[model samples]
Target: MKKSIIVSTLILSSSLTFAFDLSAIAKNVVENVTKEQTTTQETSTSNLSDTTVSNGLKEALKTGVNYAVTQLGSNNGYLNNTAVKIPLPDNLAKAETLIRSIGGDKMADNLINSMNTAASKAAPKTAEVFVEAIDKMTLTDAQAILSGGNDAATNYFKANTSDSLKKLITPIIQETMKENQVASYYDTANNLYKSNVKGLVDNSGVMGLAKNFGVDSFIPGSSDESLDEYITTKAIDGLFTMIGQKEAAIRANPLEQTSSILKEVFGK
Candidate 1:
């Protein structure tokens, strides 16, 4: 009876070992499959996310530039905005005051008004320049801009486009002033003011006349060249400033994600 019990115990032990080995094999298979699936899912999600973010940033920047240009193109856009208004600078101010003081006030005011009008009209053209700049921006540039500070994109855009924009805008502004009668106004104010401020000193003494002319540089020259230059410069500055502001707004408070691509990319 004792011999029979020992043999039975040994058979049971062998069966238990086999059952434990089978369970271990099953667990190992499940764990390996789980790990592979997890890795694959993670990689897929990451790729999707990267694609979305890239597309979203590009759309956002384009929208921002468009918005800025639209606002700047409106009436009184440059004239009404003190931050970007094209006012007569120091050299032209003296001439303006001299002319106005001498009963050429209407012409003086007209010149100033025309300068503002020309700037306002030309404001709309800046959008094209900005758009071109956007086209030139690379994928890497877009990525950096996306993660950069609020004005980083604008600054980047400006760095790339300022000289080109200025070149295009200068001629437009000059032409606008000429076509709108501001050119005549500038000429009249400068000529009249020059006589009043410097003409008297021309024969009085060379030293005194030179000094007076230096002081009169702030006035409208007996011509509109200085005023034209001043207005054009100011108009360009205003255009860029508005663009920068719009870019900053986009960076700080982006609009709703309009596309799955945008959502996927910007979700980060």
Candidate 2:
């Protein structure tokens, strides 16, 4: 009887120990599975948020660029729009004013109109340039713009597109300027204004100081290069100006969010 009791006690103890080990193994498995699932969920959420922000940024930029290009590409687009009209260089402002006062107003007007017209003619060609930049934008770039100030999107575009914009737009601007006889008009305005000035530019003493300093180089010219550069710069500036306006409007006014992506993007 004693032997049998001892055997029974050993069997019970072994069974209890086995049961405990099985319980521990089952608990560890359940805990590991739960942890893995939680990690996967967090990673997926992070990836989804980044993708959403990236897509929203691209759509917003495209929307703003298209609208700006369309508006500035239309007839009298730059000439009639005071905000974007191409003016004679600041150096020519005094000359233009004096020229107008002396009845050469039509001469100055023609030059300004021609320059603005050339810009308008070249505006349509840049839509693709901007679109390409937007397409190539990275997720990191989109994140920066999202957290940046009101002009964030515009700043991003300016940094990325300005150089290429100048390159691509220069030839088109040159062609349009030639078609418009911009050089001839520029010459007429320059000559008429110079004759009328006859060194009156020294009245303010700024011109005399420039001459004294041998800095005649400070004066702007009407050479083909100057004309082309000046007009190209103005065109790009005007484009970004329009872009900034649209971006700001979309940020500040819900009505300006024209697309669902834009609404969701800016709404955030």
List TM-scores for all candidates, in order.
0.59, 0.68
Please provide, for model 1 over 1-268, each residue's C-alpha lDDT reduced to its tens digit, 9 standing for 90 to 100. 9999999988899889999999999999999999999898777656764445556666766666666566666776666777776655565566676666679787766666677777777666776777777777777787787778777776786788778777877787777777656566555656676667556545667545546677435333344456666776777667667756765654444364455555455533
lDDT of 2: 0.80
**Steric collisions counted per model:** 12, 0
**For residues 1-268, could you state the per-residue lDDT of candidate 2 as single tens digits?**
9999999999999999999999999999999999998898666545556788789778877878887898899998888877888888766654676577779788778778878888888899999989999999999999898779878888888899999999988998788777666465665656655665545665768777877887665454433346778899999999998877777787778898877877666665
Give the poorly placed runs of model 2, Cα more than 4 Å off. Answer: 1-48, 180-182, 185-225
| Model 1 misplaced stretches (Cα beyond 4 Å) | 1-51, 94-105, 180-228, 254-268
Clashing pairs in 2: none
In model 1, where is the ten-residue run with the lowest total lDDT? 215-224
Superposed by TM-score, candidate 2 places the C-alpha of residue 226 at a distance from the truth, in angstroms, of 0.3
lDDT score, candidate 2, position 20: 100
Report the error of model 2 at residue 195, Å. Answer: 18
Worst 10 residues of 2 by lDDT: 216-225
